[model samples]
Every structure is written in C-alpha cells, then in structure tokens.
Target: MVFTAKEFLQLRETLQIAVVKCSERCLYQSTKWAAELLNSLPPLSVADIASSQNTPGTYVHPAFAPNNDPIEAALEAKELGQYLLAKSFFDCKEFDRCAAVFLPESLLAGLLAPPNDASSPVPGDKGKATASSSSHEVTLPVLSQKSLFLALYAKVISGEKRKDEESEMIMGPQDLGTITNKQLLVVSRFLKRWFDERGSGAGESSASQGFLEYLYGMVLAKEKNDEEALSYLKESVQLFPWNWGAWLEMTNLISRVEQLNIVTPKLPQNIMSFIFHAHTAVNLYQQGQDLAMSINDLISVFPTSSFILTCKALLNYHSKDLMAAEQDFSNILALHPHRLDALDHYSNILYVLNLRPKLAFLAHLCSSIDKFRPESCVVIGNYYSLLSSHEKAVQYFRRALTLDRSCLSAWTLMGHEYVELKNTHAAIESYRRAVDVNRRDYRAWYGLGQTYEVLEMHAYALWYYKKAAGLRPWDGKMWQAVGSCLQKMGRDRDGIKALKRALLADSYYDTSASSFGSTGPVDRMTQMDPEVLLQIASMYDRLEEEDEAKAYMELCVAQEDGGAANAEAGVGGGGGTILGDSVAIHADSPGAGSDGEAGEGAERAVGNEGTGVTVATSKARMWLAKYSMRMEDYETATRLATELCQDGVEVEEAKALIREARSRMEPVNMMES
Candidate 1:
C-alpha cells in the first residue's frame, strides 16, 4: 500500500492508541510496522523536487504544488516517522535506542571528540555556527520539542535501568530502593549542556523550552529537589498546558492542600488545567463537592476516559462508600480490562469486605498479567494481609516500593502490616516515610499515631492524631484516636469534647421523617459507636459529674435497645457477643469481666454467647448501680446490682456492690424498726 504523509500520521495516532490500550504487548510489532511503512514511502527532498521540475517531461503532482513548501512537508513526514519509531522503542523499554533516534550524531561525536581537536567543532557554540560549521549543522536533523523531551526522558530511564540491573545482578533481585542522585547526574549533565546550547535564541520555540523544562523538572524531582522541580514544572505547564506528564510532576511536588491551592491558579487556564486540578484534588484527598464538580466536568468532556473513572472511584473510596467505589472500579475494569492503575484500591475493598475468593482471583489475574507492576504487587500484598500472612504482605509491599519509591499505598500498607506484627519501630519508620512522600495522606498520620499510642507515647500520639484529624476532619476514627489519646493523657474535658465530635462525625443521623410518615426524626443513626458513649460516660463519672455521666449511660442503654429492636425486626443481626467481638479485651478495662474474679459464673455467661445488647445492658446497669450508691439510693443500687448478677457479667463486682448496699440499708431499716 502506498501511504501518503497524512495517512502515515493517521496510522501513527492509531498505533499510539493501541500502545496505550495494550501497553507493552504490541509495542515491538507496532515499531516494526512503522519502520516498514517509513521505508515503503519514497524519499523526497527539497533538492529532488527542485531538480525534478527542471528535468524533461517530469510531472510534479498537485500535492507538491508551488503553493505548498514541499521541503516543509518532507520534514514533517520525517519528524513524524522518527517520533513514532522512537516512541515505540520507548514503550518497548529500549530506552537507549529511543534516545539515539533523537540525539544528533554531531552532538554525540562532539562529546566523544577531544575538546582541543579542531576536527569536530562544539555543536552548540554560537560563534562556531558560522560558515565554517554549516556542513556539520546540515548533517544534524531538526528534532521536535516532544522528540527532544522523550530522548532526555529515555536517557533518565536508561540510566536508572542500568544501575538497577547492576545492583540486581549483585544483590540478587532484592529491594534496591529508589535510584541514587549519582545515577541521575549523568542525564542531568546532558540536559544542562543541551539547554546551554539552545540558549534564549529566537530559534528556540516556546514549546521546545517547555519540553526542556519538563525534562529538567522530572530529573530534579527524582533527585528530591522539590523547590527547583516545582518551579520548572510550573513553568513547563504554563508554557505547554497539554503535556500531562508535566502536570503529573507538578502534582507530586504538592504535598498539602494549601500548596495545591497556591499552585493551581498559576497553571494555564485550559482543559488540561482543569484535569490537573481534579487529579491533584483526588491525590490530596479533597473529596468535597468541588472535586465532584470538577470530575463531572471532565467526565462530560471525556466520558469514556478510564482516568476519570478511576478518579471517581477514588473519590467514593475516600468518602467511605466502599460499595459505590467497588462498583465504579468494576465498571472501569469491564471497559478496560488491561488497565492496572487502581486495582490496588479494588483489592483493598475486597480485603475489607473479606471476599477472600475474589481477592485471590484478582491477585492471581494481576500477577498473570504483570507481576512486576506496583498495583499487582499491592493486590498480592492485600491478599496475604487478608490471609493473616502479615510478613508476606510486608514483603510484597516492599517490592512495590522498590518498583515505585513514591508509592503511597505500599508504604502505608506496609506500616499496617508492621503494626500487626508488633514491630512498632518499623511501623513508625514506614509511616514516617509515607508522610514524607505525601503529608495529605491521613492514613500515614493515623498509622503514626496508632504506633505511638501502642508505645504509650500519648503526647506524640495525640499530636499525630490531631494532624490526621486536621487533614480528614470528617473521619471519625481520627477524632476518636485523638479523644482516646487525650483521655490517656488525663485531659478529661478535652477528651469528652473530642469524643463528642467523633460521635457526631461517625453517626449517619437522619433528621428527616421516616418513609412511613413518622412525625419525628427517624433514628437511623448507623455507627453511633456505643463505645464513644461509654468512654464519655466513664470520663464524666471520674470527674464526679453525676448528671452528665448518667445521661451518657442512659444513651448507651437506649443504643442497645435500638439495636435489639432492629434485630427483632430483622433489619440487622444483634451485635456480636463480648467474646465474639473483634476488639481485644483487657482485664482492667470497664465492662470486661475478669475470668479469675468471676470464676465459674463468668465462664458460663461467656459460654452462653450473649448478644451485644446483653453486654451493653450489663455495662449500663453496673454504672447505674455505682451512681445510685454514690447518691445514697440504696434500693436502686441493690436492684441494679442484682440485675447485673443475674446477667452474669461483672458478677463478682455486682455481688460486692449488693453486699455494700444491703449493709447500708440495714442501718436505715434499724431506724424504721
């Protein structure tokens, strides 16, 4: 088939789409096809077209008419062909070959030639670009901005790959961590030299400068020079807003919402800017209505985009709507089964829901598709974590980090696994690394708080918990941690205030009337967290605030009643028994009956497998008994204590309270007699 220039350009677009859809699968084949297509097209130069016009009976086609610059068309065709070939090599992981396609032979020869040698003039010298260097300049082909950027990027990747391979050969494929600055310095030096040669001449286009800036920014980012990287990336995006890679680099530099807000306005006002903002918002965990609006706008523009769908799924995930997030991810995968961007999050949902078989299937599928991918590793890690193989989970999480050092989920998940293994120090280190990568990740801050709390460092734990709470103000777990830490630090009033905030945050209360036309608000408060009420009541009791303590105790009792009613109505199962509760039991903790003290009665009660209602009722009665005794209401105290003894929870304490109440009542009875 004789392919015209326009036809070849169209084929290049098709191949690009195929590359993105299939990733590495078709890269080599596409590259070979592009090469063959390029070879089949007749080589036409300006000199040839000019010489053909002077030849006898030479026919010049209308496509190469005088109105059109045939040389420009020829150059365009050559640039596109080179770009397609280089991109294919890049996608196929032949970084050196990709770079060689763009780097001028003159520049490469100049680097190898001795500086003092008069044979090869320096490629970028301004004065040397006179008539004396015209021959060398003609030999160098003009490269497009994107082609140059890709070449530099390929060099960076090539350097990293070379270093990693060497390390792997020595260390036998263990986790080698992030690439060192020493390895990237080689690419950095070449980039600096290229820019120095280009200068601020009119010959350099704005697009060219933008690509160069983006490449330099990427190098600086990998070297951990955030300030410089941010400056370069910001400039690059402003100069060329369509480059998604530059926008992504900018996103990585922003670690906080404040920084994101500050940087957002500086971006160019265009569709890419909007997309960048939406992407950054998701990364920063800003799942507010504004983020939703931004996502909706992008979806309207690109309805079938898997990236937008992934963002939507992440928003739902952060909103605690696991089922909605799961469905969104499922839809995305159904449309684009080969996509590997957010499979880790889907695996997380499965792990939380305890869908062991499905998680296993996902892990196996991801491994089969590409085991080296970070998302696949994370999926496998979550599967191991679900199976209680925490050490294996950590190993895979570590491997994921090795693949992508800035993988936020791997660091945070590894910290969780470390915590499970009781490796507090290792967990702290992992959490700190995660925080260093992205301060907006509340999970890392929360993990840090939990680690410190386990170590009994209440002050440190409280600070970290507060940091997490500040980031995710609506997350009740963060507030609850803050409250617990404050209580441990003996700040009872502050602890109560924090606990109340947690209660408000956690409860999904419906103030509107029920569908059945109830006159009052429907008491549809899911996750009311009876433990928060108990904790607040205990604090109030310690403060000698009888009314407040009694109020919270009554609320706990009402909560249990509501739960029991739901169970009887078949709305949900009655909360599990104390022994079946997932929370660990401490002997000295309130409502935890001591086996040694209660003896055979506690054992029999535990064997009965009482519902959550029974546990809540027992706790409420125990507290009420103590409160009544404190108020000198001997009859009420005796009645409440007797009820606890019958329930068999805290049996020894209930019996002791009954004995004290009876002794006090006996004196009063003597007066009556």
Candidate 2:
C-alpha cells in the first residue's frame, strides 16, 4: 500500500464519487465509506465539501471540503476523528497518527456508516472499553487507529461529547441549528439508557426508575396507537413513580376518547380518568347532541358512581326515556337532594314541559336543600305554581322572596298568583315592589300593567305597559298591551301601528299563543268596548239610580253633592230616568226616537252615550233655549256642544262653546232664542 500523493488524490476522487452515489441509499452508510476515502486523500487539508443535496422529502446528499473557508467545520471533523481514535487506543494516542487528515466526531457520526456486522464494534459496547487500557503500552506522538475508537466511545458513553464541535461546524452563525430541548433530552436519555444497559457490571440493569419506558409511551401516543399508548403509559408509571408526564398524557388521552363518544371500561389504576369520562359525557349531552351513547358509556365505565347515574337520569329525561331520567334524578336526590344545579335543572325541565305534579316531588327535594341551599326554595315554589296550585305557588314564592329579597322573579310570580286569585290591588302592589327592585324587570312591569288594566286604572296601566314594551321589544305580548291600552286611550293611530307590529312579530302562534294567532281569537279586542258597556249598564240598571252610583261612583251621594245632581239630572233626559242601562236601550227610549228628537226639540236631553247625530242636534236646541233662560249660564249648551264636537259635526259650534265657557264662569253661552 505504498501510495503516492497523486495516487492518494485519485483514490479520494473515486471514493467521493462512490459516496455521492451511496448517499441515495443510505446516509450514514455512505458517509462511512466517504470518510475512509477522504482518509486516503492524505493532504494537509482537502476541500471537504460536505454539502447535502436534498430534494423535498428525500435525504440530503453528502459533499465535503477541508478548505480554510470552512476551517471551523474542518476542525470539528478533526476533533470528531481525534475523539474516536482516542477511544479506540486512548493511552497510545493513536488518533495523532492520523491528525494530518481526519473528521470530527459528530460529523463522522452523521457520516453514513456501513451496516454493523460481527467485526464492527457496537455503538454502545462493553467490548471496546478495555482496548484503551491495552493501548497504554504504546508510544505517544503517532497514534494507532485502535486507540482512537476507544477514547471516542468513552466520551460518547459518558455524555461528555463536546458540544462546541456542532457550534464550530455551522458557518455565518445563520445556519446554526439548535438541538431543541426535547431533542437534547432524548439524546441524553438515550445515551444514558444505552450505557447503563450495556455496562460491564451485571447488576447495573436492575432498577425501579425507568424514564425510557415512559418516553416509549410518549412515542406510542404520538403515533396515536391508543391501546399501545395506554399500555406503555401504565408500565411507565408502574416502573417509575415520578413520571408525571406519562400519567398526565394517559389521562388526557382517555378524556379525549370519552369526548369522541368512544366508550371504555373503567381503568382501576386511574380514578381521575374514570370520573373524567363521566363528566365528559354529561357535558356533551348538554350541547344538544344525542348523548345516549355517552350515558351508556358512563353506565358501563362507572356503573355504581352516583355522579354517573345522576347524569344518566338527566339524559333519560331529555330522551323522554322518562323512567330512566326519573330514576337517575331520584338517585341523585336520594344521595344529595341539596344539589342546587341538579334540582334547578330538573325542576325547570318539568316546568317548561308542563309537568305539574312532579313539582311536589321537587317540593320534597326543596326542603332538603332549603337549610343548606335556600335557592332551592325558589325551585320548589315554581313547582307549586306549575300545578296552578296558586296557594302553594304563593307560599313558595313568598318563602323564596324572604330568603332572597332581591329575587325579582319571585316577586313577579307572587304577583301572578294574586292575579289568578283575582286580587288585582294586591297583585299591583307585589308587581310594584318587584319593579322597585329591578326597574328593568319587564315581567314585573307587564304584570303591574295587566293588574291596573283589570282594575280600570287606564292611565297607570299605560305607563307600566310602555316600560315593559321598551325592556323587551321581542315580547309581542308587551307590544300588544301597548296597542290595546293605546286604543282604549283614544291614541288610535299609534295603537294600530303597535298592534300591527305585534301581529307580525307574533305571527308564529305555536311559540306565543297571545294577541296574534292563526285562529279566530283575533277578534276579541274589537268587541271589548261594547262588551264593557253592556256589563256595566246591566249592573247599574239593576239598582235604577243606585246602578249609576255603583258603576260610576261606587256609593250613593246627597242630591246637593257633585255626583248626585249629575246622576239625578239624567244627562240623557228620560225625566230623570237615565235608563241606567245599556246604551242601545237608551236610544230605543225617548233618547233618540222621533218623539225625543222632535217633541220640544228635546232629544238634546240624551245621555253621553246615547244615539245619533240627529238626537244630539235636537238636544243642543233645547240646551240653547235653556241657555237663554239662564242668562248666559250654559251647562246644557256646553254638554250638547261637547257631544257635537265628538261626532265631527258643527266644528264652529263646538269651538265656540269651549271659548265662551273659558271666558265666562257660567256654562258655555247660547244665542238668545
């Protein structure tokens, strides 16, 4: 093997070409041959153009240069060679023999290596360690190859491999890639495991601490092999008490499976994971999806858990698997009836779906929670209301209000009870108290308005009604109230517009069976005024003159008193017989008949609600005659003129009455007939 420099150059060229081809098939494998060929080049330094031609996902092709431009990389290569040679023949310093030409340890490690055989020393081997001790007999300066391999392997096994080699190899610092924390951890751990496992000492392999297995589990989890991942994680935790990552990743993995509806048998080793699965199932059910599978999963995984059983019951309720949901709810109640969330949710479902009697069942539950959780009282109170059990509803609502004075809903519900019991004044007071607590409480405002309307306090009703409408514009019933109250108050245009909006917004009858509907109940409001007049007059006429007092004044008065004179005068003159009955019958009487209109032109003596324009005009004439006799005093004229003003007739006459009445204290003046 006496090779000339030209011969060395030719051999290196041939090896580099072979290495470039071999890199395609194997990276380290090709690098092994390339290093040997570069070793043959035998120069002070060669251009070790270690470029990697990478094509997208393919491996990088190797090139090299030991030139000055890459002196640092070249030095790292040299350091790597020196380290390897020292390991193989440490005491003899055999790597110095090859110092004129060599590669760094890391670069050489990255260099493709030939396949291991019986001849190549194992990457981590006890067999090569003593080769260093044997080399101590050799002389210094020129080193042997065997010495180099021994020293390098010692550095590798000890984790004392110089990091500066990697630093030096990167040029311009821009291409300096860092070993990420995770990667460094892997390398350090891998080396430690290898050295410890392969130590010459026989008992070194036995130990309880085993991070490697946990790392392997992480590998399985990353690969998404759930069963294998769980297996490795279990083994890791069993072998090592402090491998927190393994336990955490396993719990997280199990939790996620439970999320995807994948059921599993409970893991006896992991109580937290078992409970987490049940919780996950419950959450999914609440999201509007069918959670029957989740319930079944919980049942299978945690058959005896109270939390699991409780959730199953709720799922059953939603599925109308009523028996199951009820069973679950009952089980929960039996164990812990004071669970506010469970009790409230169960009661609400019952209330919304119109399940009444169950409220009493809830009432039983309420007593249990009331001592510890007073909010449950409200839940129980609602149960009583659901049954139209107004007395009990009132009882519970008042109890809840006592516990939570700021409970606007409790106050509102109490008011509703009053309304059901026909205690309008009491209802109004409760609603007003509720509104005082929450001025924005739309329900309270609405309830107050309804109570006032029933009590015939139109002005008060209108104010509360508008507040309710403003708070909840989407509540068509509120808008409908606005329309209805406005109509009654003679604000016709605004009322009609509000009513139309109510109709449009409340178009869907299924949701709100209110003022707007697809059915014939639509005409109810149009008939209100007539219906009211009829009922009122009937009650009044029953007592004759007393009927007027009952309806209009609510009490009898002396004739000299303000109300008594007006009642006796029969504003619609039937000789002091105001008919005190229906408006229709008043017209049939002399109020607007031929005799009433023509005879003495006395139709002017009709009541405020009597008949036609003809009757009204005739009454005005009589009033005119009275005006003349009274010497400019004109109560009769004013009354008749007011009627004429309302009918859109003789606008001038109506205006004159108002002006003349303002000018003189006596009633509106008439011409001296």
Candidate 3:
C-alpha cells in the first residue's frame, strides 16, 4: 500500500515512543524485554569484588582469583575495581599501579580493602580463603553506575590489543555496585557539554526528556542496563529550547503517549476522546502540513459527518481526482440519501465527469423528488433540456409549475421549450406566466415578445417588447426586439428610434445597425419607410405616372438607409432627398393593394387634412389627376394642381414630373394670384 509520507512519519514517531516504553516497562518482568533493552550490556560497581567471586558482599577482584573462574563472593569483591578501570580508561586518565599489583584481586575485589599494590608479580595471601567479611572495613570509589558500566563495556568491545584478556573480551560484568556521585558528575559533564554545543536539535530532546524518562522507567536503553539509549538527546534539548530536531522527537514522544493512552483502551473512552478530537481536527487539517494525518484520523474516528464528507469530496473534485471524489459523494449519499444540496452538487459533478449513465440516474432521482420538492422539477427539466429532450423537458417544467405556481425558472424554461417546439402561442403563455411569477424577469418578457413577433402579431409583440425593454433598458437584445416588432408593423421610423437606443446602450454590438425585421423579398421595402411614401410611389407607378413614381421612390430610398434621413426639412436637420429612385418591389402592386392591403391606413395617407404631406402621398394625388387625363378629363387634372403652369405635360423623369404638374394647372394661380 502507498503510505502517505506525513502520516507515516507521524505513525513512526508514535510507534517509537510506544515500543520504547514497552521495552522499559517489561525489562524486569520478561527476559525478552530486558534482553532487548539491555542487550546484555554491563554495569559499573561502587566497591570491590571478592574471593567468593560471584557471591554478594564478598570483595574479590574477578581477574585476581587463584583460578580462571571464582566463587560468587570473589566476583562481587572485584566489581568496583572493574568499574574504576573502565572509568579511568574512558576518562583518558592514568591507571594506579598499586591497584594492579593485586592482579585480579583489585580488578575483582575493591569492596573490603584497597588493592595492596599495582603490577607486583606475586600470589598473595589475599587469595587465602576468608570466611568472614566486614562491610565497615570496605570503601569504594564513587561513579555513575550507568557511565561506569558503559565505559567498561566500551573497553570490552573496543577490540584493543590487550595481552591478558584477548580471548575473554566478550565477558559481561556481573555486579556493578551502586553509582557514585563523582561518576554521575562525570557522565553529567559529558552530557551537558554535548547538548550545549550541539545543533538546535537539542531542544527537541529537552521537550521529550520527561516523556523519555517516563518510558525509560519501564525499559532501559537498547545498549545497556539503563532505560535510555540516547543520553545526549535530552541534554541537548534542555540546553537549547529552539532545537527543533529534538523538539520533534519530543512531539513524537508526546503523540505516542496520547495515541497509546486511548487507542488500546476500551471502546467507551476511545469513542468519547474521538468525538472531542474530531472537533479540533477539521481546523488543524487546513492549517498547512497537517492534512493527511488529519484526514486519516478524522475519517477513522468520525465517519458519519456528511458535511466533512461533502467538503472532502469537493476538495477531491477540485484536485482533479474524479473517481475518488465520486466515491466520497456516493458515500455521502448513503448517509444522506435525500440530500437536496448533494443532489444538485452530484448532478454537476456528473456533468463535469461526463458520466452519461450517471446523468440519467441523477435526472431520475430529481424527477422522482419533483412532487416532494418543486425545485427538483427544475433540475429534471434542465437535465432533459441538456439531453435535447425538449418535449419531456417542457412536460417536467409544466409539472413543476403545477406543483408550485411560483416556480419562476420552470415557467421560464417551459416557455423556452415551447419556443423550441415551435408552439409560439403556448410559448407566449408560458413566458407570460413566468413574468407573472417574477415581474423582475426581463428574459420572460423578452421571450414573450419574440414569440409574438414570430406569430406575426406585431402590435401585441411591440407591447411586450416595450415592457421587457423597460425592465432592462440597457440590454441590447431587448432593445433589438422592440425595434424589430415596430418595424414589422410598418413603422420603420419608430424601428430606427428603437434600434438607435439599442446601439447607445451597448456600442460594441451590431443589434442597432442590423435590420429590424424581415421585409419579404421586396427590394423597395429595404429603404421604404413613412409607409405612405411607398403607397404614393406605387399609386403613381401603376397610374403610368412614371415621373412622379420615380421622384417618390428616391425619397423612399433615402429613408430606407436611415429613417433619420427622411425627417421634415427643419426638423432636426433631417433633409430627405427629393428625387425618387426606381425600386424593384416584389410585393403586391397597386391594384392588389387597393383591396384590403390599402385600408384606413391608405386613406389616411391621401387625405387632405395635413399640410406636410408625405412625398409618396402627394405624388399619389397628382398621379390620380394625371391618370384622368388619359380619359380626356383635363378639368380634373387641372384642378389637381391649380397653382402650376398650363402647358405640355410630358411623363419621363425628374423634369417631366415638374413639366406634367405645370400643365395640369394655371400659372396665374401659382402664388395666390
């Protein structure tokens, strides 16, 4: 298994403290633990070993016995001598020759009496059997039993070229007596110097000192009889508070204590502590460098937190591990199957993961919950919409509105679906409902307007478009819709007005410059506005008043480019060109129009009530008079232009238009004669 590194380090630290403590506590109880801790290392003695080599309270140097091995008492007597030798060698001090003369006696027996002499070759009476020994007659040097034993062991293992004990280097010292104050001071001096001068790792050792001591109480060091193997660590930390390496050791030790304090306990305490731990874990998890451990522990401890699961799932999702994130979300579902937030989030996850099958699954789930929660119906509707199932999408949308009349999004989408299905009337109704549900919804109003425009109901379409525009006046499309509907109703002037508004709101868009609506296949309609202008031009053209038709068509042409071009002469500098151009109008001709196409609107165009007559309308009246001339009605043509010259009336082009009108009237009536 791939281990999370941070978690592994934490586990290792905790394990070290635990195993160390176990070794310490079981040292004297189980031989295995003790052997593991001590490794059969020796101890130092405060007094001498004796003639009863291995016997207690007997003073005999172990090496000074009459034979190779000695009685128990002799071994105990020499214990302090072995320790002193070890201390002197490790301390780099000279050995005492007087102590060496007794041979194994001083080496083995320093308790009852001091060695007679050092390096004297003799078999002395001290080797004689002495049955009684007095405690008061003995004095031993002071040494830390810990350091003394270690120093002796160091010599034993040093592989030095020693002549007498070459083959006996593996022997272990048996009865190292109590530690002396001087030896302890020597060990302490070494420890203090190492810690004080070492790198900042000392602080960690200090922090962990108490904890280490606690564990040491149970098991000695792996090297010797003492519990701790690391002597310099605690001293270092004590000497340096900022020693992080040592501090880390301490933290590890503390963590192990904490972990073991409860981990192996019965369920009741563990569970209670777990609950409390989980409370703090979440915050710490995000605090940097603490995530993996936090996650592992929390999930193991408090596996039921839906909120945590969700947050974790989101983290995974954002991390680009969809499979893992999906698993978390699924687990969350198991715990909170009816979670609305989960449903929404899960659907989105599916969308991103491109899990088509799961999309359907989410759609079904949302659909099933439609009755219980109206909002879910909207989700189902959108899902179907995404699937391109407009019919079903619309069905669910309507169903959602049925469940809750205030379902604004459902109403809005239902309208859109209807539009997709080409049911403009139904679409308009749905859009209207959406707007009613939320009057602030400009989109629904816009939809309603566009649908009406599609249905060819320009006036009603214009009404809705205007309302939507009012809501979001800055919206380019809304303004575009208004202009389109107005233009469709044959009000190009108003269309231009609305389209300009669109451009002003959003200068970067093309909505304003683009045409308002379809004008069929008529080239004339491209430029024609002031609908009366087109009507008059057509009337004159059909009456064979070509010159008048030509002049009026030019004005219509100018108006088509921009309705602003066709304004009255003094009205805001709008000077419409007077000359008309020949237009290829594919729509109905004059006769077709004289029927219902030209109704009240046409009559209003030619009526004599207004002074500023449209160019096309004015031409239409004069053309009617000219047409009468073909039937020999000169009097009627004359009455049409009573202020013009009386002469030949030709019908050709621009000049012909003026020529004809002059012939149809008396010159003297021109200026109100």
lDDT of 2 by residue, 306-357 (tens): 4456666655443223333444666666665445545655654445434456
lDDT for each candidate structure: 0.66, 0.45, 0.43
**Better candidate by lDDT, 1 or 3:** 1
At residue 508, give the lDDT of candidate 1.
Answer: 24
- For model 2, the superposed segments whose C-alpha errors exceed 4 Å read 1-338, 341-349, 507-673
State how far residue 109 of model 1 sits from its true place (Å). Answer: 12
Best by lDDT: 1
Q: Which residue pairs does candidate 1 place in steric collision?
A: none
Name the candidate, 1 or 2, with the larger lDDT value.
1
TM-score of each: 0.70, 0.28, 0.26
For model 3, residues 465-542, the per-residue Cα lDDT tens digits are: 788777556444566667767655766556655654553443221121111111112121122233435544554565
Q: What TM-score does candidate 2 reach?
A: 0.28
Better of 2 and 3 by TM-score: 2
